[model samples]
Target: MAIQKQEFIERMKRLQASVRLSELEAFLVTAQDSIFYLTGVTYSPLERPFFILVRPDTGVVLLAPTLDRDHLASAPNVDEVRAYWDYPSPPGLGWSDGLLELVAGIRLLGVEPSLTQEIAQVISAWQPQAVPLIERLRLVKSADEVAMLRQAASYADLGMQKIIQAAYYGVSEIEIFSQGRAVQIQIIKETEFDPLNTSVLTAAWPARLGTQPHGVPSIADRLKDGPHIGLSFLRANGYAAECERTFFVTSPSQNMSEMFTLMLEARNRAFALIRPGVPCAEIDRAANGFLRQEGLGDYLLHRTGHGFGLGNHEGPWVAEGSPDVLEENMLISVEPGLYIPGLGGFRHSDTVLVTSDGYESLTRYPTEIEALTLLARRSMTRLRGALVRKAVGVA
Candidate 1:
């Protein structure tokens, strides 16, 4: 999906502004994500390298392989666009030949860290810049980026809803995973959004049975565990968000209810602390501290959350001792998890936009107890109730 002409212009302008201030004549972007962020083009980087050169006076130049030229056909801010037949140019030159030749005369060049060593060697003096220009610029969201993120989050929520609806005692993990992916794909098609990527996971048990934290669901694996976890992560173009919920294969025991209640409380506590100018570390501490107070600290595994946008896991991590500070319009996840060696991992995550004053949740899948009950009968009854309510116009 190509970014609007005006959005592309604004982005290049920002790059130019940064370049001018740094006394750099041009910015060389080699990172795939960086190029996608600046020009709304993505392809198989392995087959062919893509480069976006941004000059203070020349706007932007995109050098891509012929195979991916159509992705940039409608992109704006590209003052000059060129394409090579394939890598290892016909003249026996290297992959960096075309891009290096384009910016050969640049006195001082700005670069993203993803620049290959060979590419840097072609330049006169490759003094690496401190922070990646594109990543720094992407730390804050424009109105358009926020809109894309909102759309991605909506699809994630819808996928999660479908997952719980499909939950059953005998259902195979692969079955639910397929259904969830299909629903998200359907949403993208119906909404006229471009084809995107999604991850749907179903966990039948905790580490108690040596269940790996991350796994691909197998057709043979069924949801026979008392409770299972369903995680939905969706990406729209490059933007993405994640939502996770716990499902019970049968009626949850009193202890399971209590543990989940604690997890929800931890997630909420962390959510309340998100805002512009706050130290990102405190957010993690808030959740971690609460979990400790409830005697669940020992079960902590990863950080509270991480900033997300073009990259699912980016800067401003909500982890203990992190130095980054939160900023307005920064997208973050509030996923506080507790993993007991035998019981299972307890985690509930929601993507939120750090706003000017506070924060706004983007994912709105049902987190309440009634909706997450995995008991075959109870869940089916609720699903029927939802359908009935919709039919009666009172859902």
Candidate 2:
């Protein structure tokens, strides 16, 4: 389920209080995610600018494009919604006119750091301060947000399971990803989930391509007898979670097996350090330090993990040089990877919630090497995938 209206009301109230504390006559929120958090409203502004003006005493006002008026009718906690005719309207009917009218007498204004340069210049008269008030507030998840994240993580786990089952000899990566997406679609239909707010992305990086952590997948590429990275990154009901695993279609070489073990150990080390009041960097150091001691530090590519919420990747980054401290109710991923050039990549990611004591993993997919290694099974999926690829002329 999506967050209740009461939660959104409380969020707006908190933002107002923060604006008052900052001694700003008004604060402008330009980011879509921040707007959604303050008021239970979601819409893509495209080229049109959208703004939420939070005043210390005047309450919350939404300045949006006319196209979004009816769509945002049910949004809670918004005192007023003023609409502009369109993006490139005439002098008196444009977004700038409406914004200027709203903040005519405001002497002190604070705007979200995400405000575009165009908007910054338009509001330069106010000398707007770029404050991350809403971003900081989103670092910690509320009980409802945690529940949605847990539900999203469960879907991710299911997507991983489907990907593993669909991985067969000669089956293409797209075929395996398709099977995972099919299952998620079925769930969305069955539960009547909000289609716009939910998303499912399954990907496979096989053999050499796995070495490039962000490499794009090819439809022609087939899974082979080596280490493969399977990813299930999804969001359900406005909350996001990720589940990833490294699996082998057939038995792996000795070196591959050892590397997988080491990668898992690195992830566990990070997991052990997850608790309230812990520095995010410390968790990363624990895992990276262990890998460095084992002489595989050069293979470490990215941070241990990152936060998750309304957006796929948010604050409280688990990496060196991060200034964030772990707090209770923060949702984060614990993924430590080793990307060896010829051997392929070894990494596993799970969405975990930081609790008062330690942490709780929401994605409960099996991670054991034995569980990950799959035997070639005869299936029609291979034949079907090849025929579709040929028919579509996708080489």
Candidate 3:
């Protein structure tokens, strides 16, 4: 079943209670996810421009060009839908004027920084003291929010299963993307789940020597054979489960194989450490420790993972200097990768939900060395050419 309107209203009530504003008086949410979260509305109306205006105590308002008004009207929680003609744009105070008028008398106003510059300027002109309220409210996920994320992970698992079965030699990278995309669409149609847009497929090589983090190849190029390649995908809701595994087009060299194994161990160790009260920084260090022991420490890249929810990337990033404590209901990724120049890259990533005592992995693709080797064998020579280009001596 779809999220209830009453749930949304209750969320607003909580937001209202926190701010001590009987209602926000007015909150103009420009971030698409924020709009969806607050109003339970989901649609891409603004081909070029669109915005959501909410009066926490009063009602909801939608502003868009005439072309999209009909579609925007269907969004949940929208009470007064205002449409502005496109071709013959309204006079002096056209669409903006209507938006301005919608909240003309409101004293307190809130806005998301991601909102268009023009809209922010308008909101500033009307209420110079608008509060930065959106992020604070969105930073934490509720129970309904957790359920949505879990459902997205469920779909992602299904999509990955379909892609794994089809991942083979001679299939173009585009073909893999197509396969993953089709599976997601099919899942959406069959499960009646929310629409998803996320990293559905990937094939990336580590930088040179397979030892230096700085070694790199431009992803703009198409998929090729040789060095190690990694693939990660997600069947997204507003939230998603992101899982990744490396595959070799041919037998991985001894070093390449070892690197993959180490990365997997790091990820598993990190996963085991996940529980309420664990420090986020400690988790990053734990994974980084594995790379250090292997003498590939410098080549390690990015954070262990990050919070996944309404938006693909969220807060509580798993990295050094993080002050976040692992909390129940939090969903994140534990991906530790090793990238070296001249050699390809190795990474094993999975989405996980923190629990009271332990953690639950959302993306459970085969991470074992033998299983990965078989997948690489199935991929065949597509990886060789790519690896040869990265390393001068590879045959």
Candidate 4:
């Protein structure tokens, strides 16, 4: 099971109990993601709103359109399912009225910020005296929650390895991307979590010969030479993981040999500093500090990394200005990238969990840039040989 029923009730209790919300008997949860976070039943990211009424002291009550009831019931930790009717079914004769009836005695109602205005207005009119409660109490994660995040991170690592394996001479960036999707699907299925979304490599070299790889060309663009660049955008169980590395289609350049070493070192520096109780901003500073000292500060692009779980990105940002403090169960990515404008960039990212003592690197894939460069070189050599054969045949 994704999450246990008792676990969800416990989570809900934790949420309400944290803020001394005993007076709030029922919380109106409209955010679908929160519903999944609390219920562990994530079907789809639909526009249709779902509601969960919880009386921290009591239990959970779910409301959605009639069509979604069966699937919602299948969710691991959900109970007391209710639904509203659409089409020819009578209007205003559904879960809305039941929801209103359910919370009759509740004076304090909790809601997420993303609640639709229409729902808010109706809710307010129904209970004019009820105070609205904000469910922003979900920032911190528990140990179990961190485990699921670690699982998702593992899937991402597998996907990267699959990309490396599929990369070879004459293969287009799109082909590598296809292989990545297959790997993502396989990993998610093994974990029994629904696949959210996946994006693989953009291994195109620039039109100019001898220039570094990372350029955002049109989809129709072709590699001027070899050394195809690889990028993958993957989401495992709705948690997003992005990774990119440059590969030589045949042979790695002399510069690539040195850049790969620096990339791996920078990644290691960031990983070693990640620990529970550390300030989130300091994580970025620590990683950036190393790059700056190496005189490669100008090559850095994005922040050190971002938190991951449930949704692709979440709390405890690994960027500057993030005052969020790391906790034992919080999961985040420790990625550092060196992107030179005209030259290609190199980056290594892995999802990690903060532990009681220190941290756990969920991903075990080797991010040593040299290995990837060598892989690129081998692929490029094969492509060059094939091209030469074709030309000779035509002549």
Point to the candidate with the largest TM-score: 2
- Model 1, which residues run further than 4 Å from truth? 1-3, 67-73, 92-94, 117-125, 196-211, 378-395
Which residue segments of model 4 deviate by more than 4 Å?
19-26, 74-79, 87-91, 94-108, 117-147, 193-229, 237-246, 250-262, 292-299, 375-395
Best by lDDT: 2
lDDT of 3 at 163: 46
TM-score for all models, in order of appearance: 0.85, 0.96, 0.79, 0.75
Q: Itemize residue pairs with steric clashes in candidate 1.
A: none
Candidate 2 per-residue C-alpha lDDT over 1-395 given as tens digits, one digit per residue, 9 for 90 to 100 = 66888998888888888999999989999887888777777677789988888998886788888989877767788888899989899879999999998888899999998889999988899999999999888999999889888888988898898888778776686676576667577667655486666788888889878679899888778888789999999877678998999999889999999999999999888988899999999999999889999999889889999999988898989999999999999999998999998889999999999999999999999999999988857567567777756765765
Tens digits of per-residue lDDT for model 3, 1-395: 34667777666665555445624566666677766676676566444456666664556677777777777676646677887666336574366666677768878766665667676776675553446565556655677777767777765666555545545543344434445666566656755466533345433433232343334444333433444454445545456566666765456778877777788788877887899889888999889876788787788768788888776677668889987778887888887787766676777677788877988887777777676553444433446434533444322
Q: Distance (Å) between predicted and true CA of 123, model 3? A: 3.3
lDDT of 1 at 270: 91
Q: Write the per-residue lDDT of candidate 4 for residues 1-395, one digit (tens) a residue.
A: 25557777666666556335545555677776677666667666465567877665555677777888888887554558887774234656655565676667766666666767767776885453233333234455666666665666655666666666755554444444445656655765686656543333323343232234344544333343333445555665545555555555455566656765776777777777777788888878878777888898777767887877665566668888988888776778776777655455566666777888888777767665457643344655446435544544421
State the C-alpha lDDT per candidate: 0.73, 0.86, 0.64, 0.62
**lDDT sort, best first:** 2, 1, 3, 4
Candidate 3 regions off by >4 Å? 21-25, 54-57, 67-79, 105-108, 126-132, 168-171, 193-227, 235-237, 375-395
